[model samples]
Target: MRLDKFLKISRIIKRRTVAKDFAEGERVMVNGRIAKPSTDVKKGDILTLRIGDRETVFEILDIKDNVKAAEAKNLYRIIE
Candidate 1:
């Protein structure tokens, strides 16, 4: 799935546009490399999101076009 969509569907960023902007701003990385908003993300990929002075990492667990709010957390596993 697209990075932006995954972020939103997973409820990590709340909105797709915000996730796109965040990725375009170079605040996101995939597998140790900076990624764009349209980047392809798959299972097992590591994502690092820079938020101010800290970073949050997650491992993609699954991908789906749509998911219930309660099940969103199942899409990815927080690494840190």
Candidate 2:
């Protein structure tokens, strides 16, 4: 799935537009390299998001076109 779409579908960023802005502004990374809104995302891929002074990292566990709020967390596993 597309990075922005995945983020929105997974409820990570809340909205697809926000996710696109985050990626276009270079606040996102995939597998250690900078990522764009259209970057491809798949199971097992690592996602790194830089927000302000903090960095959030997680691995894609699954991909779904749609998910309920309660099930969104199942799409990724945060790596601490």
Candidate 3:
């Protein structure tokens, strides 16, 4: 799945446009490298999102086109 779509479908960013903007602005990274909105995302890939000064890292566990609110968190595993 596209990185932007994955973020929205996974409910990580809430909206696809916001996710695209984040990716375009270089606020999102995949496997430790800056990624664009069209970047491909797959299982086991590490993703890091910068929100202000804080960084949120996660490992992609699965990819789904649509997910229920209750199941959204299953798409990725948070890294501490």
Candidate 4:
């Protein structure tokens, strides 16, 4: 899945456009390197998101196109 799509589907960023903005601003990283919204993401990949002074890390556990709100967290495991 694309980074932006995953962010939305997993309910991490709430909106795909917001996720794209975050990536365009260079606030999103994958596997230690900065990533773009179109960047491909898959199981086991590490994602780091920085917003202001806060940072969150997650490990991709699964990918799904459509997921229930309550089940979104299952798509990624928070690492921080």
Candidate 5:
């Protein structure tokens, strides 16, 4: 799935547009490399998100076009 979509579906950033902005501004990374909003994300990929002075990491567990709010957390596993 696209990085922005994945982020929204997984409830990481709450909205696709916000995720896109973060990716476009170089605040996100995939597998240790900077990634764009359109970047392809897949299972097992490591994602790093720079939020102010904190860095959050997650491992993609699954990808889906849609998911319920209760199930969103199942899409990725927090690493830190």
Candidate 6:
């Protein structure tokens, strides 16, 4: 799945456009490298997103085209 789509489907960023813009702004990273919205997302990949002074990291656990709200979080695992 696409990085942007995964972000939205995972409810990480809430919207695909926002996720794309975040990537364009270099606020999202995959495996510690800047990643574009079109970047392919695969299981076990690490994603880092910067939000001001805060940072969030997640490990890709699964990929799904569509998931229920209750199951969205299962797509990724938060990393400490």
Residue-pair clashes per prediction, in order, are 0, 0, 0, 0, 0, 0
Q: For model 2, what is the error of residue 79's alpha carbon versus the real structure, in angstroms, after optimal superposition?
A: 0.5
Give lDDT tens digits, candidate 1, residues 7-51.
999999998999999999999999999999999999999999998
Residue by residue across 1-80, what tens digits does model 4's lDDT show? 89999999999999999999999999999999999999999999999999899999999999999999999999999899
TM-score, one value per model = 0.98, 0.97, 0.98, 0.98, 0.98, 0.97
Question: What lDDT tens digits, residue by residue, belong to model 2 across residues 37-68?
Answer: 99999999999999999999999999999799
TM-score of candidate 4 relative to the true fold: 0.98
Per-residue lDDT for 1-80 in model 3, tens only? 99999999999999999999999999999999999999999999999999999999999999989799999999999994
lDDT of each: 0.96, 0.95, 0.96, 0.97, 0.97, 0.95
Instruction: Write out the backbone clash pairs for model 3.
Output: none
Sliding window of 10 residues with minimal summed lDDT for model 6: 71-80
State, as a TM-score between 0 and 1, how close model 6 is to the true structure.
0.97
The residue-by-residue lDDT of candidate 6 on 38-80, one tens digit each, is: 9998999999999897899999999999899999999999995
Per-residue lDDT of 73 in model 4? 91
* Candidates 3 and 6, the one with greater lDDT: 3
lDDT of 5: 0.97
